[model samples]
Structures are given as structure tokens and as C-alpha cells.
Target: MKTLLKNGLMLDEQSKKLVKRDILIDGEIIAKIASEIEDEEAMQIEVAEKLITPGFIDLHVHLREPGFEQKETIETGTYAAARGGFTTVACMPNTRPPIDSVPIVEEILEKAEEAGYARVLPIGAITVRQLGQELTDMEALKKAGVVAVSDDGVGVQSSKMMKEAMRKAYALGLPVVAHCEDNSLAKGGCVHDGEFAKRYGLQGIPSEAESIHVARDILLAEDIGVHYHVCHISSEQSVRLVREAKARGQKVTAEVTPHHLLLCDEDIPEPNPMFKMNPPLRSKKDREALIQGLKDGTIDVIATDHAPHTLLEKQQGMERAPFGIVGLETAFPLLYTNLVRTGELTLAELIEKMTRKPAELFGLPYGVLAEGKVADMTVIDLESERPIDPSAFKSKGRNTPFAGTYVYGWPVMTFYKGVKTWDQADIFVTFEE
Candidate 1:
């Protein structure tokens, strides 16, 4: 059966404004998008004043399956992705038995298929078991259906090993997603090396800890000529290096998380674990640079490093707690309310970064709405203003600092391949003519 979405607005990328349009979807494909449509046999739904957009594609996410089920599983994580208006998510390989081999990659794909919520693209571990020692079979991993290769939880410490991996991935036309960090410089640090750590007398992770590796990886990627993508940029120095690289016309890209862009070290009222994250929050100056970087096109996309941890684990002290926070649910609203609504970033710009830019970078074919395109779209309630509640999340983990924070632009419904994967029951607006 065909579905007609009437009285909806889609972001006009060229005009930089929301324009009224109607969409007709026919079984996994968008059949038409026009100013007006008349279809007697179609099932129509009214979406007055609502925004229809391409589904967001997340590049860095941790499903925590095949090992860490207590934190999150493919079913729950993809369910969270669906609720977050994401149609496709690329999960990092940081489980007990890391996705280093074909068997592990196949298993993750199978589980995601069974769940059938959002499309889960597994990122293969760059090094076998992510030990930073032995390189995995890049060609084989790609053949086994992995989109990218990464050892995300930790960085590859050896330059020689990293260079070899990049060369192999480049030969196979694969992207090398890096978690740039020098353990030697970052060890024993829980927060950024700034006033916040100084005031609390806590160990701090310096900018060099992350930037040094970023600088190193940029050079390696330049030499290897592989698509290099930096993950979760948090420091001013790292942003500068990427900006310079882009200026030099290098084949490099980087992503900044919402937490890193919105909050800095000073925002932490206390040494609370909720604010704890890897590459910890940087100075206010760094945050400003991130916003500028995004505006100036230095940062190519915004990706949520959605790492989920159990309540018991996150409740541990700041010094001992694991580094991460659940982000899939709050990323859009936080950025929408704080950045777009405040006039820092245009609504079209934010939507482009979250939807089309990431998909373009990863070469996925799901982030555009037009005739003959995939019917993967999201319906957003621009008027729905409410506080973010963790209890309402579809994921098993409820570890976020954005709790109690009010925001706008929540995703009310999502469709993946013409399938209604998620719909907000409270905001039913469907009506017959």
C-alpha cells in the first residue's frame, strides 16, 4: 500500500528554509515529492507544521553486544536509534570479543537483522581484538560486510602498526576511523587539564594527550592516502590540526560530539561521573573553537559517540567511573535548542550535518528525500518543548547529563524503508480528508 504524508514541511537545502511539500512513499522507496498531490487510494497522514527530513545517520555508536549485554544490546541500541530519528547507525567494535574477524562481524549483522529497527552497520576492529598489536584482515573484513575499520575505545599506539593498517585499508578503499589518544599522556586523567580539574585537585588529561595522536594520524593518513576520520574531537589544538589539514587539501575528516560542542570542563558543577567522558570536556575556548569549526566547515559532521554504561557503573566516583554517556536520544534536541534556535547554527545547517553530511562522508545512500530515493525519513515536532527524561529512552542505559534540560525539535516518528519503525503515540495527527 502507498502512504501519503500531507501538510508537511521539508528543509529546502538550496533556499535554507522550510517549504511546504507532500510526499508519497511506496514500499521502501519514495515515489514522489511535490507541492501538492491527489491520490484516492493512498493512506494519508496529516503532519501540519511538522518537519519531514532524511533520517539521521550516526557514525560512531556502541551497541555493546556479543560481550557487554548489560550495557546495551543491538535490539535496545537500535531501538534507541529509531526513537532518536536515526535510520542507520555504524556501531563501534569494542565488545568482549571485538569485531576483528568475519565471524564476529557476521554475528553482529545477524543480530541487527533480527532486531529490525534501525540499520546497524558494524565497524570492524582495526587491530585484532583491539590490542594495538596485530593488524586484522582489512580486505577480508570489508568483504564480510563491515563499512569501516576502527579500534574506537582505544587508539592504536604504534605508528608503524597504524601506518600499515591505513595502507591496507586504503588499498581496499575503506575509511580508517581513529580514536586519537596517547595513553602515555592521557593515563590517570579523568577530566580536561584546566581550571575545573585544578579547582578540584584532580588528575587532568592535557590537550596534547589527544592532539599529539591526531597530528600523528593526520600525517600517516596523508602518506597512506586513506580516508582518515577523527572521532570525538575535544581540544582546540586538534581542531586546528584538522582545519590546517583541510586547508592543505588533505583527504581527512573529523567529527565533534554534542557533549564536546555544548559543554566544557567548567560546566561540571562537581566531580560527578555523569559528566565524565573520554577525552574529557575541554576549556570554554575549545568549545568556542568547535562551534566555529563547524560553521567554517573545518568539522565535516556531528557524530554522537553514544557509549552506554549501566547505572551502577556510572554511579561510581568520577575517578573510577568509566568514560562515556548515552547520547543518541539527546543529541538532536540539545543541538537544536542550544545551537540552531539560538542562531548559532541555522536549522538547515544542523539538519544537513546530521542527515546528509555524514551519509555523504560514509557513502551511504539514505540521507536524501526525493523521487526514487529510499523512504528513510523522520518526522520532527518543532513545537514540542519538554525536558529530556532518561526513563523514556528506549536504550537500557540511562547515563546522560542532559536530564532535566528542556529542549525543542524532538523526533516524533521515523520510517526506515517505508516501514514505520517508531511513532510517538501521544502526538497522533493523522486525519482523513
Candidate 2:
């Protein structure tokens, strides 16, 4: 069966305008997009006044399968992603056994296929077991079907080892997605080393911890000419370095999370773990710099480092609890409300960060609603306002600080490969494949 979406305004990224268009999806491919696409056999659905864009892609996400099922599973995580309007997510390799070997990577792909929602591209570990002492076989990992190589939870500590890994990754034509951190400088600090930390008498994690590694990795990438990507950039200096590297025409890219752009160290009301994350939220100045970075093209993508920790793990207080918070369910609405609605970023700019930029950076065949492209799309309700309720989240990790915040631009329907994967307003008309 064919599906025809009518009366939807499609975003024109180049002109920064929304043009009214109709889409006709045939099987798994988008067959046509024009002012009025008529197909007698198509099941037509009127998406009047709604915005239709390419489905979102989150480059950094944690599904927590094969090891930490209690925290999150691939099925639940992807469900949360689809609810957030994402049709593709690149899951981080920090599972129980970690996605280091071919078997583990294969397992993730198989499970995601069985789950049947968003496409899950497994990120293979840069080092075996993510120990960082010895490098994993990049060739084998790439052949096993990995989007990239990363040791995301922690940085590759040994400079020599990292250089070798980058060399190997370059040879395999894979990007090295780094979690930039110098543990020696970080010194076990939980929150940002700024006024908030000093006022609360909490140990601070200095900005250099992240930047030092960022600088080091950038140099390594420049020397090796590999596609080096910085993960969840939070520091001002890190942004500056990436900007300078890009200015020099080096192969480097960086991503910023919605939480870091919207919240700062001062926003932490109390000593709560929800506000705690690795490369902890910095001062207002840092947040401003991150926004500016996004505006000026220093930040190439917006990835929700959607790390999900169990409630018990998060309830251990700011200092004792593990670092991380859920983001898949709240990222778009939070950014759309706070950033786009406030005039900090245009809807096209924000959508580009979440869509085309990630796809272009990773060389994935997504993030476009053109003819002959995969029919991965989402219809958004840009008019309705709704409060975020964590209890309503499909993810097991109900750990977020955005609860009770009213926001607009809710995703009402999501289609992945022409299949209705998620529908909130009963608008999805199923078409036989």
C-alpha cells in the first residue's frame, strides 16, 4: 500500500522557510514530494498546518543492553527515541560486556531488528572492553557493522595508545568519536569547578579536564587526517579549539547536548544527581559559549548523550551517584521550547543540527525527505503545549530534571521506512508493506 501525507509544511533548510508540500511514500522509499501529489491507490492523511521534517538522528545514545538491562534495553530506548521523533540513533558502546567484538556488535544489530523501531547503528569500542590499554581490531569491528569507534564513558588515557587507535581507525575509514577527558585534571570532581561548586563546598571538575583531551585529540586527528568527533562538548575552551581546528580545515567535528545548552551550574537547585553528568555542566559563560558555538557552526551536531541510570543509582546523591541523565524523551521539546522559541536558534538551524548535519557527518543515507530517499520522517505539533511527565516516558530511566516544564512542538507521528513506528494523536494510517 502507498501512503500520502497531505497539507504539511516541509522545512527548506537552505532558504530557512517552510514550504507547503505533499509527500507520497511508496513502500520503503519516498516516491514523490510536490505541492499536490495525487495517487489514487494511496492512503491519504491530512497533516494540516503540521511541520514534516526528516526524522531526527541522535549520534550519541546508550541503549544499555547485553549487560545493563535494568537501566535500559534497546527496545525501550528506541521506543523513547521514536517518541522524541528520532528514526535513527547511534548507540554508544558502554554496555555490560561492551560492544568490542564482532559478536557483541552483531548482537546489537540483531536485537534492534527484532525490536522493530528506530535504526540502531552500533558504535564499536575503540579498545577491547573499553579498557583503553589495548586497541580493538578496527577492521573487524567495521566489517561487523559499526558506525564508528569510541570509548565514550572515559577518554583514551594513553596518548601513544590513542594515536595508534586513531591511525587504525583512519585506515578503516571510521571516525574516532572521543569522550575528551584528562582524568588527572578531572580528579574525581562531580560538578563544574565554578561558583556553584565553591558556594556549595563541592569538589569541582575543572574545564581543562575536557579541553586537554580535546586539544590532544585534535592534534592527533590533524596529524592523521582522520574524521575526529568530540562527544558531548561542554567546555568553552573545547569549543574554541574545535572552531580553530575547523578554521584550519582539519577533519574535526563536535556535538553539544541540549542540557548543556539550556542549563548551567547555577541551575542546580540542590545537591541532586539529576544535574550530575560527566564533563559536568559548567558556568553561565560556558553555556553561552556553547550556544554561540552552535550558532557559529563550531558545533556540528546535537547528540543526546542519552545515558540512562537506574533510579537507585541516581538517588545516591550528587557525589555518590553515577553521572548521567535520560535525554531521548525530552531533548527535542526542551531545545525547541528554550532555544528556538526564545529566538536563540531558528527552527531550521536546530533541525539541521539534529538531522542533516549528523547524517552528513556520519555519511548515513538519512536526514533528507527527497525522492528516492528512505521514508523516515516525523510530523510535529508545533502549536500544542504540554508538560513533560517522566512517568509517561517509555524509557526505564525516569531520570530527568525537565519534569513539569511546559513545552511546544510535540512529535505526534513518526514514520521509519514508511512504517508507522510511533503515533501519539492516532494519526498514523498503516499501509501494508
Candidate 3:
């Protein structure tokens, strides 16, 4: 089957063009990209002034399959991803069973393949059961289709264990995505250890807790000659460390979330559980540092940590509630409305972080719009306005802090591997008329 998309602006960092063109898709590859293509048998799609770009790729997401289905399943999570314009996502292995072994990794891969929505790449756990004691079967897991290794949700406490994991992953030619946090310093803390926490009479998690682990991981990666990636960076010190590490020619990369870049602890009002997340929102200065890091190219990508939890779990008091908020459905709108529209980042740069940069970093082959590339694409209505509504979400978990926020620029349609899997209004609208 051949599909032709016309009358859309192609936004690519390498070459920005605003011409009326048609993208001819033959099977699962883009057959051609040209102006005034006369194909009488092709199905024509008029985008009518939308922006067509390569599908977004999120490097950090929690699908909660195999164990925590109540929070999210692979099917539901990928549906949410498709709605959010992501054609591929690298899932964190902090599941109920924890993707620590070859069997577990294979199970996730099989399930994702069966689900058949967004491409799900399972990350293998760095340590057995993520206990940070001993490394898992890295080679076997890699053979089972695991793209990377991590102990997300909790950082490895022992430098010895982390160094060993890095060494094994380095030898295997896989990147180690580090969840930077010093458990010793983060003991029983719920929010950022700053004036907000002090004023609320709650124990705060210090920024040093995050930066210390980041610094250690960078040095370990340098010593072991492995690729190290920092997840959900939320501290100025951590950003500074990553900048310096890059300058020193270390194989280190970092990602920041939308919440960490846009919101701060000062913006949290009255201990709301929705606002609660691990590596909790930091001070304004830290927020500024994250923005600057993205602008200066210190941060390599923008990922939606996209953690989902039950309403009952999030309803608990801020101190007792689980850490994390749903991000997939809101990431693009929040970024476009706040950052790109405000001149903080160019549209090309934003698309680059969401697409090509992540694929290049992770060694994936699905984040570009060139001919002969995989036809994973998203058509975005850059001027479309909408209010954030968690109740209308595709995922089972709707524990976001951005509910009711007005935002612009949403994904209208998403195609995965030449198949139209998600058409938002067609799939989501309740009223037939």
C-alpha cells in the first residue's frame, strides 16, 4: 500500500523547508519526498498547514509491565506514547519483576511485539533485582533484545558495583543509563531539600545526593571507557558536572524532563501529591541551569520519565505518596507552549532532542524523515490549543500535576512503521456527531 502526505511543512534540523510536498510511503519505508508528485493511485492526505516531522523517540519511560499492570501495561503505555507523538520508547526496567535476567527481558520484548504499538525497547537491570549488590547477566540480556542497562528508580549505592556494571556494559558495547542518587543522603526524604521543604516542616532530599552520584558515574565511565547517561537530571551541580565531563572528553550524556525544566519547588503549592516526584523539583536557579544546559548543548536529550501510578497511591499525603507523575501526554504540549513558543528553544532544536538526537545516542534507526527511512512519523498541529485533561488519557494511570493547564501544539496523527495506529480524535472522541 502506498500513502501520500501533502501540504505540510517539513521541519528538520539539517534543512528546514516550507514547501508543499508529498511523502510517498511504500510498505514501511519512505519511498520518496518531492514536490508536485503526480501519483494517481496513491491515497492523498492533506495536512493543511501542519508540521510533519520524524516520530518522537523517548529514551526514558516506565511501562510497568510484567508486574505493575495496575499502574500501566505495555499496551496502554504505548497507546499513550502514540498519542503523544512517540513512535518508539526505551522503557526503564524497574518493573515489578525487574528486567534483570534474560527470561524477563525476553518476556518484555515478546509482549511489546505482541502489543504492536510503539516500538518498546526494554532496558536490562544493572544489578540483580536492582538491589545494587551484584551485576546481572549482561551478555544474555543483551542477546535477548535489551538495548541498555540501568537501575532506575534507585541508583546503585556501591561504587564497586556501578564500576563493575559499567565495565561489563562497556565491554558489551551498551550504554549504562544511571539513575543518579546517593541513597545514603536521600534517606526518607520526599522533596527537594530546600527552603520549600524547610518551610513545610518536611525532610528534604539535598541536591548533592543527585550530583554526587552523577559525578561518580562520570568518573567511573571515564575510567572504564563506557558510555554513561544520566537520567532525569534535576540539579545545577549535576548539570555543571555533566558540562565539565563533556569538556574533559568523557563518554557522558544527560537528559532533563519537562517538569524539571519548567517547574520548581517554589511553584509547588501546599504539599500536593501530584507535584511530588523523585529527584523532586528543585529551586529556580536549578531550573535556570537546566534550561541553560539544554541551550548550550550540555544536555543531549529531552525525555519524559513518563512514570504512572494509581490514584490511590498518589492520593496519599505528599510524604507517604509514591514518587513520579505521568508525562507522555503532556510533554510535547508543555514544551511547545512554554519553551519553543517563547523563543527559549527553536522548533528544530526541540524536534532534534525528541527525535534524531535520541536515536543517534541509543543507536536506533527510526528518527529521521529521509527517503528509505522507516515511516515512523507524526503530523502535529502546531497551532492547536487544548486544555490538559488526565481523565481523557489513554493510559490507566493519570497522576499528572498539569491537569487543566492550557497548551498548544498537539499531535493530530501518528504513524508507526507505515501503519496508522493512532488518530487522536477518531479514537478518543466520545460524541459521534
Candidate 4:
């Protein structure tokens, strides 16, 4: 099948300017991109006024499959990802039976291939069963098609265990992704250790909880020469530590979630569970630091730690509720409107961070839009406005705090490998006779 997309705008990387282009797709590859194209034999679609770019890539997300399928599954999660403009995502290894062995990793791959929505990259657990007791077979896991090794959802408490894992991963050419939480420091806490927790008379999770582990992991990675990455960075001190390490020329990288960038603890209207999340929304100062970190090159990528939980589990009160919120369906519009439209970040910067930067960081070839490349692209309505609605979400979870918030730059349509995956409003598409 062949299709031609007309009247689309793409950001020129070299000049950082929006340029008009017509893209032609043949089978699964972008056959041609030019100022104008005419093909009577091919079906054509008019995009009206929309921004076209490579499909977004997310480096961190949770797809609860294999054991915990109620909250999310490979099919539902990828549908949410496509709706949000993500074509490639790297899933964390925090399931009932964590991705510790070759078989589990292959299982996820098979499930994703069967789902046929988004490309799912499985991350292997650093420790067997994520117990932090013994390192998983890193070399074997790498050979079995794992991208990185991480014990996400919990920190590796044993420094000795973590160092050994780092050594093995480095030798095997695998990056070690750290969750960065010290159980002793972060344990028994609900909200961030800030004024909000104090006002609500609730327990606070100190910044030290995450920073301590970040510091330790960075030091170990620096000495052992492992490619290290920090996940869902939400603290001021952690930002400072990562900044210092990058300054020292360490192979350190960090990711920030949209919730941390878009909302702070002070933005939490009340003690509602919707506003609750692990590494809970931090102080106003920390939010500022995170933004500055992104602008100043201290942070490497922006990921949707798209953890989904059922409303029943999330409504269990602040202290008792689980630590997460659904993000895959709402990340782009929220960030584009709040950051890019507000002039805090340019359209190019946001797209660069969401697409190219992540692909380069994780070493994937799916984040570019050009001739001869796979047609994994999306068309976004940058000028259109819509209110955030969880009811329309494709994922099984509806635990977002951004519901009812009006936003712009929503994905109107998504194409993965030249196949239409998502079409908002069932927009117009023309087929030739």
C-alpha cells in the first residue's frame, strides 16, 4: 500500500524552523519527502495544519504483563502509547515475576510482536527477581536481547551487589539503569518531605532517600566505567549530584518525568490521592531545579514513567495508596502546552527531547523521520485545544492528576511502520479507487 500525506509541517533540525513537506510512504518505509509530491496511484490524506515528526520514544514505562495484567497489558499499554505519539518504549523489569532470565525477556518480546502497536524493549532485572540478593546473568540476558539491566520499583540496597552488577554489565556492554532509592531512607514515607507533608500532618519521604542511592550508584559507575542512568529524578540534590558527575566527565545520564516537570507539591490542591506518587511531587524549588537541569543539559531525556494502577488501589488514601499515575496517554499534550506553548521550551527542543534524544541515549533507530526510514511518525494538532479526559483513555488505568486540565498539541494520528495505529476523532482519510 502507498499513501501520501500533504500539508504537514516538520521541524528542520539544522535551522530549528518549521518547514512544509509532503511525505510519501511505500509499504513500511518513508519513500520520499519533498516540498511537493504528486502520485495519482497512491491514496492521499490532507493533514490540514499539523506538525509531523518521528514517533515519540519513551525510555521508562511499566507494562504489567505476564503476572499483573489487570492494571495493564502489552496490548492496552501500546495502544495508550500510540495515542500519545510514542512508537517505541522501554519497559521496566518490575513484574510479579520480574524479567530476570532469558525466557521472561523473550516472552515480553513475543507478546509485543503479537500486540503490533508499539515496539517494546524489555529491560532485564539487575538482580535475580529484583531481590538484590544476587546479580542476574547479565551476559546471558544481553545475548537474549535485553537493552539494559535495572531493578526498578525498588533500589538495590546492597552496595556490594550493585557494584558487582555494574561491573558485569559494563563488561557485557550493557547500561545499568538505577532506581535510586535507599529503602532505609525512603521507607515508611508517603508524600515528599516538604511543607505540603508538614501541613497535612503526614509522613514525609526525604530527598536523601533518593539522593543517597544516586550518589552511591554514580560513584560506583564512575569507578567501574559502566554506562549509568538514573530514573524519575525528582529531587534537587539528585539533580545537583548528577550535574557534578556529568561535569567530572562521568558516563552518567538521568531522566525526569512529566509530572515532576509540570507539577510541584505546592500545586497539589489538597491531600487527594490523584496528586500522590512515589518520589512524590517535590517542592517548588526542586521543580525549578529540574527545569533548569533540563535546559542546562544536566538531564539527558524526558520519559513517562507511565505507571498505571487501578482506581481502587490508588484511592486507598495518601499513605496507603500505591506510588504512581498513568502518563502514556497524557504526557505529550501536557508537556507541549505547559512547557513549549508557555515559551519555557521551544517546539524543537520538546520534539528533540521526546524523539531524537531518547533514541540516541538508548541506541534505537526508530526516532528519526527521513527518506528510506521506517514510517513510524505522528501528526500532532499543535493549534487545537482540548481538555484532558481520562474517560477517553485507551489504557486500563485512569489515575492521572491532569484530568480536567485544558491542553494543546495532542496527537491527532499516529502511524507505525506505515500503518495507522491511532486516529483521534476518526479523522478523514482518503483511499484511491
Candidate 4, position 406, lDDT = 93
For candidate 1, what is the total of clashing residue pairs?
0
Q: List candidate 1 stretches off by more than 4 Å.
A: 426-433
lDDT of 2 at 307: 86
**Which residue pairs come into collision in candidate 4?**
none
Tens-digit lDDT string for candidate 2 (341-372): 99999999999999999999999999988999
Number of backbone clashes in candidate 4: 0
TM-score computed on alpha carbons, candidate 4: 0.97
Query: What is the per-residue lDDT of model 3 for residues 1-433, given as tens digits with 9 covering 90 to 100?
Result: 9888887778644466455667988889999988766677788888878888899999999999989999999999998998899999999999978999888888888887887778999999999889988899999999999999999999999999999999999999999998998988998999999888999998999999999999888888899989999999999999999999999998899999999999999999889999999889999999999999999999999999999999999999989999999988788889999999999998888888999999999999878998999999998888878888888888888999899999998888888998877786753473233
Model 1 TM-score?
0.97
Candidate 1 lDDT trough over 10 residues, lowest sum: 424-433
Candidate 4 at 154: error in angstroms?
0.1
* TM-score of each model, paired residue for residue: 0.97, 0.97, 0.98, 0.97
Candidate 4: where are CA atoms >4 Å away? 426-433
Cα lDDT tens digits, model 1, 1-433, are 7999998999886887889999999888999999898898889999889999999999999999989999999999999999889999999999989999999989999999999889999999999889999999988999999999999989899999999999999999999999999999898999999999999999999999889999999999988799999999988899999999988999899899999999999899998999999979999999999999999989999989999999999988999999999999788889999998999999988988898899989898878998999999999998889888887888888999888999999898899889888898733332111
What does candidate 4's lDDT look like per residue over 228-335, in tens digits?
A: 999999999999999999999999999999999999889988888988887889989999999999988899889999988999998899889898999987898999
The alpha-carbon deviation from the true structure for residue 379 of candidate 2, after best TM-score superposition, in angstroms, is 0.7
